[model samples]
Target: MVFDASARRRLAPYRMYPYLLMTVEVPSRGITDQWRRTGLARLLAEEIALAT
Candidate 1:
């Protein structure tokens, strides 16, 4: 779900308790640098799924 620009509380803290095993793909350094420029250092669950 794409959100509007004025959505309230767009950013929040993420905590993983007793973490489960999963295949995690780490983005490349170049991608991370680009995100930092755009203030997108992290992503929501839905956004991550969409990205994959």
Candidate 2:
């Protein structure tokens, strides 16, 4: 979370067996309108690339 709670999921990269990156968008006039209520959902994905 580099920026804030707004940056929690938005600015974070998952730390796991196969690390991943993600991006999220917020709606203009819905719950996301309020930074405190942007209850985004979790997803499952496969890793395609990695660097060492």
Candidate 3:
């Protein structure tokens, strides 16, 4: 999704939550580099879907 300034402001607080939560807390932290991005994207999609 294309985000504007408003979206950035809305998400600024929890920006690290998703990345660190899924990576640091979960053992799946094994995912690194390119694949790491894919994992984070899936996490974001799940969040958006749940929010909707």
Name the best candidate (by lDDT). 3
* Residue 36 accuracy (lDDT) in model 3: 63
List model 1 lDDT by residue over 1-52, tens digit each: 8645433234222221111111122243234445343333233444444333
Model 2: per-residue Cα lDDT at residue 27: 37
Go through the candidates in order and give the C-alpha RMSD of each one to the true structure: 11.2, 13.0, 8.2
Could you give the candidate ranking by lDDT, starting with the highest? 3, 1, 2
Ten-residue segment with the worst summed lDDT in candidate 1? 14-23
Error of 3 at 17 (Å): 4.4
lDDT of 3 by residue, 1-52 (tens): 9877677657754764766566664446565576566777677666555434
Which residue pairs collide, candidate 3? none
Which segments of candidate 3 are over 4 A away from where they belong?
1-17, 20-32
TM-score against truth, every candidate = 0.18, 0.19, 0.39
Task: Give candidate 3's error at residue 18 in angstroms.
Answer: 2.7
Comparing 2 with 3 on lDDT, the higher-scoring candidate is 3
Candidate 2 lowest-lDDT run of ten: 43-52
**Model 2 regions lying over 4 Å from their true place:** 13-52
